[model samples]
Target: MAEDLHEIVARALMLDRSAITDDLKYNSIPEWDSVAHMALIAELEAAYDVMLDTDDIVAMSSVGTIREILKKYDVEA
Candidate 1:
Protein backbone atom coordinates (compact mmCIF):
# COMPACT_ATOMS: atom_id res chain seq x y z
CA MET A 1 0.00 0.00 0.00
CA ALA A 2 2.79 2.41 0.89
CA GLU A 3 4.60 1.63 -2.33
CA ASP A 4 1.42 2.10 -4.30
CA LEU A 5 0.83 5.48 -2.67
CA HIS A 6 4.34 6.62 -3.44
CA GLU A 7 4.13 5.44 -7.03
CA ILE A 8 0.76 7.02 -7.57
CA VAL A 9 1.87 10.34 -6.13
CA ALA A 10 5.09 10.29 -8.07
CA ARG A 11 3.36 9.45 -11.33
CA ALA A 12 0.65 12.03 -10.81
CA LEU A 13 3.11 14.76 -9.89
CA MET A 14 5.69 13.78 -12.50
CA LEU A 15 8.25 13.30 -9.76
CA ASP A 16 10.64 10.61 -8.69
CA ARG A 17 9.42 8.36 -5.90
CA SER A 18 12.24 9.50 -3.63
CA ALA A 19 10.81 13.00 -3.72
CA ILE A 20 7.51 11.92 -2.24
CA THR A 21 8.09 12.36 1.45
CA ASP A 22 5.48 12.49 4.17
CA ASP A 23 6.23 16.18 4.56
CA LEU A 24 5.54 16.89 0.91
CA LYS A 25 2.58 19.22 0.73
CA TYR A 26 0.27 20.41 -2.00
CA ASN A 27 1.35 23.61 -3.69
CA SER A 28 4.70 23.33 -1.94
CA ILE A 29 6.34 22.58 -5.27
CA PRO A 30 5.56 23.35 -8.91
CA GLU A 31 4.80 19.72 -9.65
CA TRP A 32 2.25 19.53 -6.85
CA ASP A 33 0.08 22.46 -7.80
CA SER A 34 -3.67 22.45 -8.34
CA VAL A 35 -3.71 20.54 -11.59
CA ALA A 36 -1.40 17.84 -10.30
CA HIS A 37 -3.39 17.69 -7.09
CA MET A 38 -6.53 16.69 -8.94
CA ALA A 39 -4.52 14.19 -10.90
CA LEU A 40 -3.14 12.83 -7.67
CA ILE A 41 -6.65 12.54 -6.27
CA ALA A 42 -7.81 10.67 -9.33
CA GLU A 43 -4.89 8.32 -9.13
CA LEU A 44 -5.39 7.70 -5.43
CA GLU A 45 -9.10 7.05 -5.87
CA ALA A 46 -8.54 4.68 -8.73
CA ALA A 47 -5.75 2.85 -6.94
CA TYR A 48 -7.64 2.55 -3.67
CA ASP A 49 -11.05 1.94 -5.23
CA VAL A 50 -12.58 4.72 -3.18
CA MET A 51 -14.27 8.01 -3.93
CA LEU A 52 -13.04 11.06 -2.06
CA ASP A 53 -15.54 13.73 -1.13
CA THR A 54 -14.95 17.47 -1.37
CA ASP A 55 -13.81 17.69 2.24
CA ASP A 56 -11.47 14.78 1.93
CA ILE A 57 -10.05 16.22 -1.25
CA VAL A 58 -9.51 19.57 0.42
CA ALA A 59 -7.96 17.94 3.46
CA MET A 60 -5.37 16.09 1.46
CA SER A 61 -2.86 18.89 1.69
CA SER A 62 0.19 16.75 2.45
CA VAL A 63 1.37 13.16 2.15
CA GLY A 64 0.68 12.64 5.84
CA THR A 65 -2.79 14.14 5.54
CA ILE A 66 -3.48 12.02 2.50
CA ARG A 67 -2.59 8.91 4.47
CA GLU A 68 -4.92 10.02 7.23
CA ILE A 69 -7.76 10.70 4.80
CA LEU A 70 -7.30 7.32 3.15
CA LYS A 71 -7.48 5.73 6.58
CA LYS A 72 -10.97 7.18 7.01
CA TYR A 73 -11.97 5.28 3.90
CA ASP A 74 -10.40 2.08 5.29
CA VAL A 75 -7.35 2.42 3.07
CA GLU A 76 -4.15 1.73 4.97
CA ALA A 77 -1.09 3.32 3.49
Candidate 2:
Protein backbone atom coordinates (compact mmCIF):
# COMPACT_ATOMS: atom_id res chain seq x y z
CA MET A 1 0.00 0.00 0.00
CA ALA A 2 2.86 2.34 0.70
CA GLU A 3 4.25 1.48 -2.68
CA ASP A 4 0.89 2.19 -4.25
CA LEU A 5 0.72 5.52 -2.44
CA HIS A 6 4.18 6.36 -3.62
CA GLU A 7 3.28 5.50 -7.16
CA ILE A 8 0.17 7.67 -7.04
CA VAL A 9 2.08 10.51 -5.45
CA ALA A 10 4.94 10.44 -7.94
CA ARG A 11 2.77 10.04 -11.01
CA ALA A 12 0.29 12.70 -9.98
CA LEU A 13 2.99 15.23 -9.21
CA MET A 14 4.93 14.30 -12.33
CA LEU A 15 8.01 13.78 -10.22
CA ASP A 16 10.65 11.09 -10.28
CA ARG A 17 9.78 7.98 -8.30
CA SER A 18 12.61 8.71 -5.88
CA ALA A 19 10.98 12.02 -5.08
CA ILE A 20 7.69 10.54 -3.91
CA THR A 21 6.76 10.37 -0.23
CA ASP A 22 3.90 10.66 2.21
CA ASP A 23 5.69 13.64 3.66
CA LEU A 24 5.54 15.51 0.38
CA LYS A 25 3.13 18.29 1.20
CA TYR A 26 0.54 20.06 -0.87
CA ASN A 27 1.38 23.58 -2.04
CA SER A 28 4.67 23.18 -0.25
CA ILE A 29 6.07 23.34 -3.75
CA PRO A 30 4.69 25.02 -6.84
CA GLU A 31 3.91 21.72 -8.52
CA TRP A 32 1.45 20.65 -5.85
CA ASP A 33 -1.34 23.14 -6.10
CA SER A 34 -5.14 22.79 -5.96
CA VAL A 35 -5.38 21.45 -9.48
CA ALA A 36 -2.73 18.88 -8.72
CA HIS A 37 -4.60 18.01 -5.53
CA MET A 38 -7.81 17.14 -7.39
CA ALA A 39 -5.85 15.31 -10.05
CA LEU A 40 -4.03 13.35 -7.41
CA ILE A 41 -7.33 12.33 -5.80
CA ALA A 42 -8.60 11.17 -9.17
CA GLU A 43 -5.44 9.19 -9.77
CA LEU A 44 -5.65 7.58 -6.33
CA GLU A 45 -9.29 6.58 -6.80
CA ALA A 46 -8.50 5.11 -10.20
CA ALA A 47 -5.41 3.29 -9.01
CA TYR A 48 -7.03 1.86 -5.91
CA ASP A 49 -10.48 1.35 -7.42
CA VAL A 50 -12.07 3.08 -4.46
CA MET A 51 -14.02 6.27 -4.24
CA LEU A 52 -13.08 8.72 -1.51
CA ASP A 53 -15.64 10.33 0.71
CA THR A 54 -15.94 14.11 0.58
CA ASP A 55 -14.50 14.29 4.06
CA ASP A 56 -11.50 12.38 2.83
CA ILE A 57 -11.12 14.76 -0.04
CA VAL A 58 -11.33 17.80 2.21
CA ALA A 59 -8.91 16.30 4.68
CA MET A 60 -6.21 15.62 2.17
CA SER A 61 -4.53 18.94 2.57
CA SER A 62 -1.04 17.44 2.59
CA VAL A 63 0.62 14.18 1.76
CA GLY A 64 0.54 13.12 5.37
CA THR A 65 -3.14 13.89 5.50
CA ILE A 66 -3.64 11.97 2.29
CA ARG A 67 -1.96 8.89 3.71
CA GLU A 68 -4.12 9.09 6.80
CA ILE A 69 -7.25 9.38 4.73
CA LEU A 70 -6.26 6.41 2.57
CA LYS A 71 -5.70 4.38 5.69
CA LYS A 72 -9.28 5.10 6.74
CA TYR A 73 -10.37 3.61 3.43
CA ASP A 74 -8.48 0.42 4.31
CA VAL A 75 -5.60 1.10 1.97
CA GLU A 76 -3.30 -0.56 4.52
CA ALA A 77 -0.76 2.19 4.83
Candidate 3:
Protein backbone atom coordinates (compact mmCIF):
# COMPACT_ATOMS: atom_id res chain seq x y z
CA MET A 1 0.00 0.00 0.00
CA ALA A 2 2.81 2.34 0.93
CA GLU A 3 4.63 1.45 -2.25
CA ASP A 4 1.51 2.27 -4.21
CA LEU A 5 1.33 5.66 -2.60
CA HIS A 6 4.99 6.26 -3.31
CA GLU A 7 4.52 5.30 -6.90
CA ILE A 8 1.60 7.66 -7.31
CA VAL A 9 3.55 10.53 -5.78
CA ALA A 10 6.65 9.76 -7.79
CA ARG A 11 4.74 9.62 -11.05
CA ALA A 12 2.76 12.73 -10.31
CA LEU A 13 5.88 14.66 -9.41
CA MET A 14 7.98 13.04 -12.13
CA LEU A 15 10.46 11.74 -9.62
CA ASP A 16 11.89 8.37 -8.79
CA ARG A 17 10.39 6.38 -5.94
CA SER A 18 13.83 6.57 -4.30
CA ALA A 19 13.54 10.34 -4.27
CA ILE A 20 10.25 10.32 -2.45
CA THR A 21 11.17 10.59 1.18
CA ASP A 22 9.11 11.33 4.25
CA ASP A 23 10.42 14.88 4.31
CA LEU A 24 9.40 15.58 0.74
CA LYS A 25 6.97 18.48 0.79
CA TYR A 26 5.13 20.52 -1.79
CA ASN A 27 7.75 23.21 -2.19
CA SER A 28 10.66 21.22 -0.78
CA ILE A 29 11.35 19.62 -4.14
CA PRO A 30 11.67 21.42 -7.45
CA GLU A 31 9.33 19.10 -9.25
CA TRP A 32 6.75 19.54 -6.54
CA ASP A 33 5.78 23.08 -7.47
CA SER A 34 2.22 24.39 -7.43
CA VAL A 35 1.36 22.81 -10.75
CA ALA A 36 2.80 19.49 -9.69
CA HIS A 37 0.99 19.74 -6.40
CA MET A 38 -2.34 19.97 -8.22
CA ALA A 39 -1.37 17.06 -10.40
CA LEU A 40 -0.40 15.04 -7.38
CA ILE A 41 -3.72 15.81 -5.76
CA ALA A 42 -5.58 14.69 -8.85
CA GLU A 43 -3.57 11.50 -9.06
CA LEU A 44 -4.08 10.65 -5.40
CA GLU A 45 -7.79 11.39 -5.54
CA ALA A 46 -8.25 9.26 -8.64
CA ALA A 47 -6.08 6.46 -7.34
CA TYR A 48 -7.73 6.35 -3.95
CA ASP A 49 -11.24 7.32 -5.04
CA VAL A 50 -11.38 10.08 -2.48
CA MET A 51 -11.88 13.77 -3.04
CA LEU A 52 -9.61 15.77 -0.80
CA ASP A 53 -10.99 18.93 0.68
CA THR A 54 -9.37 22.30 -0.02
CA ASP A 55 -7.99 22.47 3.49
CA ASP A 56 -6.54 18.99 3.22
CA ILE A 57 -5.03 19.90 -0.13
CA VAL A 58 -3.31 22.92 1.39
CA ALA A 59 -2.31 20.91 4.44
CA MET A 60 -0.74 18.18 2.35
CA SER A 61 2.71 19.64 2.54
CA SER A 62 4.84 16.58 3.09
CA VAL A 63 4.65 12.88 2.46
CA GLY A 64 3.88 12.25 6.14
CA THR A 65 1.17 14.90 6.06
CA ILE A 66 -0.26 13.36 2.92
CA ARG A 67 -0.54 10.04 4.72
CA GLU A 68 -2.34 11.69 7.59
CA ILE A 69 -4.71 13.47 5.24
CA LEU A 70 -5.40 10.25 3.41
CA LYS A 71 -6.35 8.69 6.74
CA LYS A 72 -9.14 11.26 7.03
CA TYR A 73 -10.60 9.82 3.83
CA ASP A 74 -10.09 6.26 5.13
CA VAL A 75 -7.17 5.59 2.83
CA GLU A 76 -4.69 3.51 4.78
CA ALA A 77 -1.04 4.25 4.59
Candidate 4:
Protein backbone atom coordinates (compact mmCIF):
# COMPACT_ATOMS: atom_id res chain seq x y z
CA MET A 1 0.00 0.00 0.00
CA ALA A 2 2.85 2.33 0.79
CA GLU A 3 4.36 1.50 -2.57
CA ASP A 4 1.17 2.42 -4.37
CA LEU A 5 0.93 5.62 -2.30
CA HIS A 6 4.51 6.43 -3.18
CA GLU A 7 3.77 5.99 -6.86
CA ILE A 8 0.82 8.35 -6.73
CA VAL A 9 2.78 10.99 -4.81
CA ALA A 10 5.86 10.62 -6.96
CA ARG A 11 3.92 10.92 -10.19
CA ALA A 12 1.86 13.83 -8.95
CA LEU A 13 4.83 15.70 -7.50
CA MET A 14 7.16 14.86 -10.39
CA LEU A 15 9.58 13.21 -8.02
CA ASP A 16 11.76 10.16 -8.18
CA ARG A 17 10.71 7.05 -6.26
CA SER A 18 13.73 7.28 -3.98
CA ALA A 19 12.69 10.73 -2.88
CA ILE A 20 9.60 9.43 -1.23
CA THR A 21 10.09 8.35 2.37
CA ASP A 22 8.05 7.79 5.51
CA ASP A 23 9.28 11.12 6.85
CA LEU A 24 8.26 13.00 3.72
CA LYS A 25 5.86 15.85 4.35
CA TYR A 26 3.92 18.12 2.02
CA ASN A 27 6.19 21.17 1.99
CA SER A 28 9.30 19.22 2.94
CA ILE A 29 9.72 18.41 -0.72
CA PRO A 30 10.14 21.59 -2.74
CA GLU A 31 7.79 20.36 -5.44
CA TRP A 32 5.08 19.44 -2.95
CA ASP A 33 3.94 23.01 -2.63
CA SER A 34 0.49 24.49 -3.25
CA VAL A 35 0.34 23.90 -6.97
CA ALA A 36 1.52 20.35 -6.68
CA HIS A 37 -0.75 19.83 -3.68
CA MET A 38 -3.77 20.36 -5.87
CA ALA A 39 -2.31 18.15 -8.53
CA LEU A 40 -1.61 15.47 -5.96
CA ILE A 41 -5.18 15.69 -4.71
CA ALA A 42 -6.47 15.28 -8.25
CA GLU A 43 -4.19 12.35 -8.86
CA LEU A 44 -5.20 10.66 -5.61
CA GLU A 45 -8.89 11.14 -6.34
CA ALA A 46 -8.49 9.70 -9.80
CA ALA A 47 -6.27 6.87 -8.68
CA TYR A 48 -8.38 5.90 -5.67
CA ASP A 49 -11.78 6.92 -7.05
CA VAL A 50 -12.64 8.88 -3.91
CA MET A 51 -13.34 12.55 -3.40
CA LEU A 52 -11.55 13.96 -0.37
CA ASP A 53 -13.23 16.51 1.79
CA THR A 54 -11.80 20.01 2.10
CA ASP A 55 -10.96 19.30 5.75
CA ASP A 56 -9.02 16.25 4.77
CA ILE A 57 -7.16 18.21 2.11
CA VAL A 58 -6.01 20.82 4.59
CA ALA A 59 -5.18 18.19 7.17
CA MET A 60 -2.92 16.17 4.94
CA SER A 61 0.61 17.04 5.98
CA SER A 62 2.80 14.01 5.54
CA VAL A 63 2.90 10.56 3.97
CA GLY A 64 1.65 9.07 7.21
CA THR A 65 -1.09 11.64 7.40
CA ILE A 66 -2.05 10.94 3.82
CA ARG A 67 -2.54 7.29 4.63
CA GLU A 68 -4.75 8.21 7.56
CA ILE A 69 -6.76 10.68 5.51
CA LEU A 70 -7.39 8.17 2.75
CA LYS A 71 -8.54 5.64 5.30
CA LYS A 72 -11.36 8.00 6.21
CA TYR A 73 -12.63 7.61 2.68
CA ASP A 74 -12.20 3.83 2.86
CA VAL A 75 -9.05 3.91 0.74
CA GLU A 76 -6.78 1.05 1.75
CA ALA A 77 -3.62 3.06 1.38
Estimated TM-score per prediction?
0.93, 0.84, 0.92, 0.92
Better of 2 and 4 by lDDT: 4
Question: Could you tell me which residue pairs clash in candidate 1?
Answer: none
Q: Write the per-residue lDDT of candidate 2 for residues 1-77, one digit (tens) a residue.
A: 34567777888989888986767877888878989888888998887778998877877887778877887777864
Score each candidate by Cα lDDT: 0.89, 0.81, 0.88, 0.88
Task: Give the Å shift of residue 49 in candidate 2.
Answer: 1.2
Q: Name the candidate, 1 or 4, with the larger TM-score value.
A: 1
lDDT of 3 by residue, 1-77 (tens): 43478889999999989998877878976899999999999999899988889999999999989998898888986
For candidate 3, give the lDDT of residue 38. Answer: 96
Q: Which stretches of candidate 2 lie over 4 Å from their true place?
A: 1-3
lDDT of 1 at 39: 93
Of candidates 4 and 2, the better by TM-score:
4
Model 4 clash pairs? none
